[model samples]
Target: MKLVWTQIKNFRSIKDSGKIYFNPNLTILAGKNESGKSNILKALECFSLDKFNKDTDFPIDYIEEEYPEVIVHYQLEEDIVIDLCDTLKINKENAHKISGVTVTRTSEFLESIEVDIFKDTLEYVIDAVGEAIKVINRELKRTFKLDINSKSSYLLSDLIEKIDSYLLTIKEFFNEEQSNKLNSIIEEVVSHLEMLNGFSDYISDKKFKATIPNFIYFSSFEDIIPDSISSNEEITPIVNRFFKVVNQNPKLLFDESNPQRRRLLSDKISAGISGDFMDYYSQDSVSLKINLDGDDLNFFVYGTDTQKPFQPRQRSQGLQWFLSFYLTLQAEMKTGSVLLIDEPGLYLHASAQEDLLGMLNNLSDKSPIVISTHSHWLMDPNRLERIRLVLKVNDQTQVENKIHKGADAYTMKPIFSAIGLGLNNDISTFGERLILVEGYSDYYYLEAMRYYFQEILGIKIKKFKIYPCLGSAQIINVLTLLVDSETEYFILLDNDKAGRQTEKKLKAECGIDENKILFTPVKSKNTSVIEDMFSQKDFSEIILDSLDTNKFDKVLVSKKFNERMHNNEITILSDETVSNFKEILDVVATPKFSHREN
Candidate 1:
């Protein structure tokens, strides 16, 4: 089962969050600080919690003293519904009506079925007996001067006996064919009545609970306590729970009698933590050890650089937080669980945050993760479909699942910061007129070309800020932010299918003017990328400098350029690469800005 939507009322800052929809794999709740992003995660956490606190959780604006109700709606998968039916003893026919099925008394079962087939059969039998009694009464009154009253006790008993005998010999009352038809009708009616009764009984007797998805909520990294400190505190329960999950026996942590079990558990945990540490640091010789100091668990890491072992607290805060979070998830989380992480990359550096992002993405394959984040490195630009904008409106929290094309500057600030921070370079504050490119290499090449054109052609062009959009797909997100900033911008996309599609989408969906969009000029008929703007010889030389000369090929230069650019190395544009670059600048610099005095 998956949580398709959520609505919170009278919960903290959110009065009524309307209906916040979710993506199956990953849902990112993004907003400014104090926009109640964490509150939304907490509301979801309520589903898994055993008790609720009205005083702390309820909205203060509520005038009446009433308990707060947090209602969450879930969608059950077909397999889950089938399993539920089997568990509840609900037959296949009745299972179809599970969503609408209600308890009804045995006396009220007849009213529950609209098609009264059982009632009709009883009526048919009663009429047949009445007719036979009428004939008997007429014959008795004429021959013996005796009229039989249908309501008289003796007459009723005699008539019931005759009806019973007639029903027993029902086959004799009709031909073989008629008997078969009659029996079939009676059997069908009987089966329908039995099914109705059984369904009613099942509904009345069985208490079926909704299959609530398991929710695991993680807030700030500060809440994560190191395994070294052994105390009966808030984190002790989580540690105990994690140990039980990892070893299936919490006693192994303290049971001195079972040294073998203790050793085995320690080795397993040590190997698991060491493996994660190696993957994280990309070092083969890194070793991790888990030791029990009295009742407390301690972690010690040994790196290839240092012979001495150091505790986790001795490491950076970011590494400590990440290790704790990762280990906790590994030990505590089960398959099909829903993870709610609040500001996951809060402590990590931008690069480490990226690694955390990748880990979260991989973890999402096993369980759906809904993360509330202000970090751009955490948000996947390619998966904008999973983003939800949490905003404060009229003092109530509102979550918008749809990404607005015309999002204002304030709303787009976090995204802009995220993108800019991830690039590790601030967008040039040269001029309001922005020149957007597909990638970093494009920005570097264009800037070099602009200078070359100014020097060679003696035409001083308007200096526009060269902004790299990271990818063609991310252009719209940047544009949305730029438009809000009232920044006049022009796009230079690669002459490829993806670039063309992005250009078309920018024009149609984002309402970008067609004249503002430009494609790289290429001599060949093949689809042109940013690398095409430069001479093949110049680009190949740059590639050779970065990669092995033996690996250099005309066909592989473009791919190599991208690889080099990702490593923050851009090949400077030469004089020979000026024509295509000059052409693009000439068009963009036309009547757009005040001309520079020659």
Candidate 2:
């Protein structure tokens, strides 16, 4: 069975809501913080619950004293319906039955009776008499056998004929509409009750809790393991034991921790898994164990031999955050639960962050994963239908609100732009390819070049988008975005001192693979730049060659001067600002072609 729709009223930030359809396989709730995304999730959790804990406030009130209610609707398999019916004690005669046959037959009988009755007002009176005769006929049929000379039957038949004659005469006096109305009333009174056995069985069946399966969530940051174990042991036992509890029995997750019992284990377990995994511990391949002399716990991290435990708060904020979520994933797997992770990419190295995203994608096939993050590195546009945007509208606004599925990167670009989120664009639109330019000159230059290329080559290129740093000083920011996106970048910068410094900064700060960057050679001899200026120079010569000699002579101050000297701004050339060379001026004049390209 899958939850098809859910509605909430006066619940926290949600003043009112309508049906929210969910994909059974995966449903994601995403939005900037405080958009009521969490509230919707909470409502789902609340609707399916048997009881609310002390942490929860019941009957959430948003309008003065109005109580809020949440309703959840689900679609179940036929077998699940049967199980429900068996559990709810719904019988064949109960209203919970879903079949339509019995109800339809009863309706048809009533409709037929109404159609056949009194033809007019006069007929209505006659119909009453006809009804009396029918009743007498029924009595006769029940009380005695029909015989040639049964005096009692004959008397009843004579009375019925007399009534029928009066009813026919009266029918001729009344309008047809009035007669039909009267007939309908009579038919309704005579209709039998409908039997709803199927519905009863289905509705009365036992309710089963929806258990969403779980997946892993890796954090983005990486940290160095301390050289010496601080009185620590391996985390193998703790990891294995936690998974055992989750897979074996998830209910224990809800149980309050027994401080005394846990303390005894803590001396040997140090930071053993918490939350919902303690109850299902079964000896598995994963070995979770205590470390830091029972003060910490560690778990296996791929591509490494020794287990790493949680770090001290002062060590690294990102690592500390990551460890918490990593542990949560391990715990979730054991309980067959869904994972709800918020921002798993905090404080991690770029490489580590990419690795984390890869890990999560792999785990999603096994279980549903719901992550609320601002990082674009984790998004895969082709697989974006699972994404949902939670929009929070002002209560004062008299407008309808809804949740929308994110279709692709292009679809979400405007939304990301509104929130100042460059990450989403980098992931969905640019992917792993980047073009880093020094400033707006490069930005506009690249754009212009692209247009020219498309027209010249007749082949469109849109693999990578150019990112213009405000200046050479912002190269580090550009590099970080590129690295986080896990793509190589081509840094096109001016060959000036500032540009060289920019390159050095990226090299020292970023230390990414050499293949990731495509830089210029430092020496003047290596100035074989693949630039638009050189191309423009060739194009300029072609245009000068094609122009009328007389037109050029009129524009040039001295025909004997070299073509280069006339083109240079320093030399005296023409009185008019416009040039005889149309190609260059035409390109510059056209708004579409004038923009710069990196």
Candidate 3:
């Protein structure tokens, strides 16, 4: 089953968060602090757990009047219907009727109803009535001139009326038994029709909480281990469950005669944790030691070089968090649990966060993971469909699946930062000059050249920031936000059709001076992009080093420039390319060039 969408209303800061759809594997709820991202996750938790306290969980603004409600819409896999049928004790006919359902929650009750329960029965009645009409038409061909040969030829309402009217007229011609059968058929059809029409009355919530999938919420790993060895009271529910799974009997740890059993159990659990840690951290031979001393469970880790084991708390926060999280999930999570993680990599470095992303992706194959995060590194830019932007509008929280084009710069700042442009007002003003590039590759190439020029020639260029616009079209949007009175802006566009159109819009539509729009110097070809500014030999060598030789193409070179730059292996540029770069820098750095039309 998949949580396809959710509708939140009057919940916390959210007055009405219009229906928000979710991605199948991963759904990222992204927003700034206090923008109600956590509130949305809590609402989902309440929906899954079916527990809502009016005084605590209810929206404070509306708590006096009435508690708010949460509605969750789900799309179940076909096989899950079989399980539902078995659990509900519904017969095959009714079981087939039990399609996907919607769950709604209020302070008083949690309700569930089948989305299309009456569809099959209604279809059956329609087909049966049409067949009867066909029989009547054939039998009374000369007597009546009704053209009800095919059900598809007429609407359901018109067909029903025609059949009813014809049946009444023919009642006198038939005997008592025949008249009764005809009446029963019409009555059955009408009854089914009534049931189909009265869908709202037929559905009600049941007490089958077992049918709802479990929601496991993990915010932190601090409580994964017990504080002392006195008792297991401080251990988290997930940890307790993990121990139960790892050890068939909890008392086995205290069995003095069965020391081998204790060692085997400890070794097994330790191996599992160690394997996962090694896989994610890419460390060589890290081992774990799980010791049950008295009523306490102690966790320790040993690196390859360490002679003694280190307590989990003594290690780095990221390592401890990752180990505890991975082990808990590996031991506790069942097949169909919906995992809700809030800020999963809060303490991890960028590289480890990336590893966490890979781990999350792997876990998603078993269960859907919905994570709330402010870290751009946590988001996969390649999967924009998995992102939902949360923003506060007029003091009401709104969750948007797609970022609105008209959203102001502040509203768009998170997404901009996720794509790697420092667009905050303070950072935007750090440089006296701004060089707008079409994409990240352009930014990287220019910055790399700027450094090269400074190093090779000792000519200190003016301090400028290269702002990548994501694309030529986005340039207009970025300009709308970043353009101010003090800053001098220059747009470097390719000499392609899109670049030309963008240039036209910048000048005519945006009132930007034509001189501010810079294009790649004309090479041999009329169509030249930023890549054409670099020498072919050096550019091809960089591409070859970054990607496979067979995949070396102009498109890939332009697209994967950021990845190549991050690799830090290709820093060489041809002398001609360096000269061309110097000339462009000289042109942009001129005092007269900075003062030309705002």
Residue-wise C-alpha lDDT for candidate 2, range 1-598, written one tens digit per residue: 3334455655566666665544343455555556666566655454434222323433233344444455544444455445544544434343223211100001011100000111122234334444533544463453322222212222223433444454454345446764564454444322210112222223233433232111233323333222223223453433433445435221232232665654465443332443222223221112233322233333322112334433344345544444444555555555555555555666766554555565566554455456655454455332233445566565310112122232234434433432223644344344445566665334443444443344432333444556655577876765655445655456665665676676677678778544444443333344423232333444344324445666553212111112222223222222221132222223222333232253
Q: Rank the candidates by lDDT, best first.
A: 3, 1, 2
Candidate 1 local Cα displacement, residue 60, angstroms: 0.7
Q: In candidate 3, what are the lDDT values of residues 294-346, reduced to their tens digit?
A: 56667777888757888867777877777667765555345467777877878
Rank list by TM-score = 3, 1, 2
Model 2 residue runs over 4 Å out of place are 50-61, 82-288, 291-315, 333-336, 342-360, 395-598
User: What TM-score would each prediction reach against the true structure?
Assistant: 0.54, 0.39, 0.60
Candidate 3 residues lying further than 4 Å off, grouped into runs, are 63-66, 82-99, 119-186, 189-211, 227-235, 244-249, 255-257, 283-285, 331-333, 404-411, 424-500, 503-598
Q: Which model is ahead, 1 or 2, in terms of lDDT?
A: 1
lDDT, candidates in the order shown: 0.61, 0.41, 0.65
lDDT of 1 by residue, 48-121 (tens): 66345566676777556443444554555667557546744556575444432211111111112111222333
- Best lDDT goes to which candidate? 3
